[model samples]
Target: MIYFYNLLLLILCYLSEINSARILGIIPTPSISHQIVYRPIWKELSQRGHKVTVLTTDPINDSSLKNLTEIDLSFSYDLYNNKHNFSDKIDKLAGKPLEMVNAIITMNADICDEQLKHPKVKRLINDPNEHFDVILVEILQPCMFAFAHRFKAASIGVVSMDAQSAAYDSVVNPTHPILNPDFMLPLAGKLSFFERVFSVVISNVMRVYEFLFIIPINDKVIRENFGDDYPSCKDFIQYLDMLFVNVHPILSGIRPNVPAVVNIGAGLHIQSPKSLPEDLKSFLDNAPSDVIYFSLGSNVKSKDIIPSTRQIITETFAELPYTILWKFEADSLPNQPKNVKIMKWLPQQDVLRHPKIKLFITQAGHQSIEEAIFSHVPMVVMPFFADQEGNAKRIVLKDIAVKVDHKELTKESFKSSILEVMENKKYRENVKKLAELLQDEPMTGLEKAVWWTEHVIRHKGAKHYRSAAIEMPFYEYFLLDVIGFLLLVLFIVIYVSVKMSKLVFKVIFKLCGGEKPKFKRH
Candidate 1:
């Protein structure tokens, strides 16, 4: 009996050891902000004993985590840095929705092609012994979905921004143009007649553009890399088990979401702030008054700003009593203000946590906005492109930030916006209230994401959680068939009514001895 009990214990231990899975993460985008959102997810899975293989531009090379395997695609980053003029593109693409979409699609295609051609990725693809239980892909680049299909793995999508319009198609959710506006358009709630018409028309145009142009390019790339035997991008979308989006009801307005859609917004990257470096701490501690933290995020380098705009910013800062800590990439700035301190980079989260930090001057990127909200720091936004404009408008609408168009920025305007936010305590109060609501969730975003990911792996694609909308055609989903039936019934009723009236009229005319009306056929 003793021997049998020991044998049973050993068998249970063995089962536990083999329970962990091999997770594959494909994040080929060169954008650092995107890397920031995805890195933590794979890292957490690795920490929990799953073997994680990540192909990314930014690799968190922690030697301590034995389960993590990061394939460095920093070469892609180098290519983008050397070849692309981001500042100019941002300037030109602002408010041009179609052009912006085209630019992203083209850029992502180039990156995806380069990623597939890399030797490490090629070897992984060719290796017959390799296997994964689940594959996590960046949702922006749909071409990468082929990897999930090829590996025969359960697929989970990661979006660094709010659930975009294109993502609705994957889960088969209704993308009502007015209710769920495209990320490019800065629209929310109750639009005027002209605005509503424009919204519907533009939204449909974008959908057509994606279908006609973007999907074909994606299909071509997948076929070239993975071969024609593989399923098309649309076919592979059905394999997606869940999508983790960086959206919160508190930050982004509440919208209808399918069961497979998970909102891990502020919690996606927000963690306990680490201790600031000594020099940075000293700088903040020594400040005479409250400091304003300024950064345009990693993608938008401060040096890229036009000289005149830079001068206007400097002049505005010089007028303020608050100290300014700017994330300027350059070694030095000409005519730098006495109160302004420039650094190539600063620990943003740590700085935001400081009590003396009064305001954040930001580009209003999703990640930056999340950080600001997490820290209860109000913002003065100068939005540039992509979702930044929408994010800025949302923050402004929430009454937690002031929006200053970068193109219209001047010393006076910049100074006034800053002063307005600083003087008004309501902005600070609103942000703090929002932070409380965000923190009040039942489970942290990270926990929810991990739970859902592991659930998919364990259940072999968690089909029960999938929305019923996926099985319905577009007409069926909107009950257009039902509408058609009602219309048909109405037509029959009208026809019957007209015939009855004509018969009654004829009888009445004959009874009254009236002349019959003559009908002419042309």
Candidate 2:
């Protein structure tokens, strides 16, 4: 028996080596919310005998994962933290579309710039011996996509949010300016005339700006690092092997994707519920009634909230009948209520999975919404910036949540929104249905992600999955060229017929009365 077991272990080792790949993943978005989406991916790939080298802001420094190599790009967060404070800008950037877009574009470029400057990253790029079967890069940072060019490997664009409008264009995935709108915009549902105009105008304007100004800037950065002979970032984007979008139809609605694009649902980082910490367990386990879990996610700190709003929240919570678990960063609230429990951090998934959790008051981050749905809890979304507003609108449209206007937030409005979702049976019912649909897929999201990643590596590239629309010009793809040709032919036929009719009229008149007309003219 011992001899047979040894032989089986040897056969398994041989198979692992035969199928193993060298994967390079550079997901340098400094947000923990973003990093969590891909963390599971790295772990899964390594466990399957792939040699994975990842450059990330949040490193899963687990020594147990012997096949994973994590390059710490945590300092990129400093480049952001030193330059800007997200807490201050979160509310201010809301509803300011141009400002919000410009900020995101600048930050993407800046992060890419900082990523190239890191000593380990520089060595990795400079090393002539380094090779990879595939490179997974952040779709947000086009400059970093140059790694694919340098390594001469298949490139897969990975985004932690729903695929943005510009991203769809890169993959030739179907998108409508008003109907599908950019995720960054706060617009959704049936648009009013002005809203439709705004969506169409802004989406086109940004598309042009991104192609002309942003891509050129990113291209220059790429050429600087990867050499001038490297292809333009625009060209690189057009040839992406595959794009992994963190979207599922259950939450984000039904959107079209090309064969090259894969929807690896948003709950990638969610793990099985663990035993809660003693303090939280005691607080939750003994709650007198139902509980409300409130959090604004990682980027927006609860302590940074304005004093007036804080007071309003405190006063309102004091009157509520249920227990409130507020993820407040500070140690204590000025006037804490007996029913309110403040914790600096939370195991959000575990907390939401608690039986007593009735409703979640969230900032409407995608992952947070996914967690709430997965746990079958409803939400009162207070969207602040970026995709949060759109996510809030989507969840509300799906009948799984309610939205509170952060701009007009008051004690009454805040309290009412929370109560509305908690008291309504429809919200809970809708969320439960959504959770079931999301979980009813043939393969789990993580499994699908791993399968697709390996598929690209196994085939060297997913060129067969590429869309013909990617190779076509905009006029041809929209059939405007064909339409123009038909219109031109119709015009020519009408012009010729008019001329023929006039000439025949003159001929008939002359033939009938030629001599009489000539005498009159003389």
Candidate 3:
């Protein structure tokens, strides 16, 4: 009986192994904000019995997740920090669409080079035995997508924010350039004619740059790492089985998405409120109902603000009745107000969940905005760069927040924006209403992401979900060939009709015995 029981146990273990898959996630971006949004995905997949190996810059080193393996690529941060100073350029490249695109494309190429050459990545590549059943790659880094093809796995694109126009087009989704501008552009709302023109120009320029510059760099990287026989980087788009974009109808306006695209942007990184630190809890507990939570998110540091703007912020905070919790990176802030509490880092979601909190002053990152909405807190959004400007526009349009332009920031403007969000009852109501809609989804973002990921794993690939539009030629997809044929037919009919009219006139004139008096050679 004991021998029979042991044999049954072994058989059960074998069945489980056959059912589970090996997933490789390449979230190689250096930003903490980007990594945090995807953390839940691998963790949940591991919990569900799949073996997950992630090449990541930020690894949640949890011993409990026995099935998860993390290959740390934290060195990418050194390259990122040495190359780009986001703080110094808040007033410069933040508003310039072309310059920003150039900067990001250059940085992605640089990071991709170092990432592919890293020792651990090379080991994974050279090991003939290594295989992944699925590859979840960050779509922003096109070079990373090569891993999907390298492993011969079903590829899925993932983004921490809304998908770029180029990525949308790659999957054959409509861009609606004027109605929904690309994430790189700062212009939002009903655009002026020039803004509309600028959007179209900038959007196309990015796609052209990706084709001419970015893809070549990616192709070169693939050859150096994978092999010379590796397929072209542009060809990888067709193998994309699904895209898990961090967007929702409430965040971005209602837009069409292909069947394979799933939105997991509804606070995927948000967690249940944890116990706040002692000092922090004391601060919030004793504060008034108008307490303010201020953070610029992880990528942008509060201590890095220019001196003049810092002074304006300090003075404005001093004048406000509400206590402020600021995520100041530095250990000490000179002349910090008594009512203001400064911490290098704070539990942002927990702080927002506090009952005493009234308003959030933020740089309007997508993740931060999602948290504010989840907590039903209105905002005073001072957008600095990237998608912040667009997010600020979205919330302001929804009437849940007031936008304070970073360039036009003043003590009075800052104070009034804060007061407006706190003093007005409608902002809170609008936020609550929007939050309800966001929360009304049938499954949470994590569930949707994990379910679809497993779905792709179960089926081996999702080629069926791929849009037929992706395979269509440009002329055929747009019906330009059909249009050209119709135009040609119309031209021939008009030409023949003109010739026939002239012939009829000649016959009539000849029958009437009219002489050829037409030639008056002047």
Candidate 4:
């Protein structure tokens, strides 16, 4: 009986141990917005007794989480901010498709180089004994997949936005250019002829761009940092077992996905709004009318906005009776209006949840849109770049928001959009309906993500879940070979039939004493 008890205890401990895993996350991008999408996932896994190590630009240094180890690459942020003014570039690259691709590739390559060279990351990479059950690399930086190969672990991709981007094509199911909008284009469902042509052209161009430029950059960086023995970037991408996309069908539109592509779009990492600071709470509680919250997201500082545009925005808000809460970085604006309030930062999601807040003016970032949808607030979107344009266009198409061109933001146009969105009850209703659909999911995004991460660990890569299409060549995927075979058979039949007819004719001609047709040879 004592021996039996010992065996039972051992079994129980083994069962408990099976639930945990060692997960390595490579989130080299310095953008705070990108970090927000991933931090909750890593935190949840750590809390669940799994060992989680992250090489990140934004590190959560909470001491209490014993299972989590963060290798800080925050220096990448300073390097990026010092080298480039992203706010100014947003305006310049808004409509230029080729330039946008070039800029994004350059930025991602630079960040990847910095992360691979960081001392802590270098040490971890070179350590032969270091191993992980799985490695999670952000999809934006494909070169980071080298870590998965080096660690001999299952690879999972975590994308901050929808999986419609060409960058994700290798890992996800096939994307139709006509049905699915590219990350660069703003058109949505039921596109016109011109739009369809443009979409196809742009899609092909992007694929070429990826092949000729992006992949080479990633390959060079991977070879440099991880050595030549590591697989090429494209080869590393093929080894990805699954992808977690932060997009729900309701917002991102319906598209076919393989089993490996999991949608965790509903989870926005929203916490219960903390008790508001006394002064801010007092200001919100005592608002005379409904409030308008305006923010350009984390990347675009208010001070960097052009002076004329700033004047137009302030003037437009002056006309509104509602209180205007602007997330301005500067301490003071020279001619601030009485109704407007400027803060260096604001708890955006919490503010949106407040009953007095009616409409949100935003840069139409993916996370911000998700937050607004969750809070059932309509928006006035001024899209800047990347997926923001696509997100803004979709919001407008859904009838839950109005769009204002940031470049042409005159006082008249800005105020008119705000007034239209604020006065319209339909916009509010549509957004609330969307919120219902988003919140109706059985599992939170974080819960789903964590469960899958453990699932991969438990199964040791979950290779069974991989799609057959991942191994298929472009011609095979489209069945061009099968089609060619059918065409060849038809040609043979026609050739044989023509020859038989000619022979029959010649026999008949000879029987009837008719001359056979003579052929002239060159």
Candidate number with greatest lDDT: 2
State, as a TM-score between 0 and 1, how close model 3 is to the true structure: 0.95
Candidate 1: tens digits of C-alpha lDDT, residues 447-485? 888898999988988778888878889899889999999
Q: What is the TM-score of each candidate against the true structure?
A: 0.94, 0.94, 0.95, 0.92
Q: Give stretches of model 3 more than 4 Å off.
A: 1-7, 510-522
lDDT of 3 at 228: 94
| Order of the predicted models by TM-score, top scorer first | 3, 1, 2, 4
RMSD of each: 3.5, 3.4, 2.8, 4.1
lDDT by residue (tens digit), candidate 3, 1-522: 999999999999999899899999998889988999999998999998899999999989999999999999998888777766545655577677677767777787778888988888999998899999999999988888888887899999999998888788878888888988997677678999999998988888888888888789878877888899988877886568998899887778778889888999788999877999998888888776468889998877888887788889999999988888899999998789988989898888899999888899999999899999999999999888888888899889999999997677899988888888898999999999999999898899999999999999999988888899887999999899999999999999999999999999899889878876466687
TM-score-wise, the better of 3 and 4 is 3
| Model 2, position 188: C-alpha lDDT score | 77
Candidate 4 root-mean-square deviation in Å: 4.1
Q: Each model's number of backbone clashes?
A: 1, 0, 0, 0
Please, what are the lDDT tens digits per residue for candidate 4 over residues 97-164? Answer: 78976887788788888888988889998898888999998888888988888888999988888864
Checking candidate 3 for backbone clashes, the offending pairs are none
Model 4: pairs clashing at backbone N, Cα or C within 3 Å: none
The stretch of ten residues in a row with the least summed lDDT in candidate 2 is: 513-522
lDDT of candidate 4 at residue 92, scale 0 to 100: 79
Quality of model 1 by C-alpha lDDT: 0.86
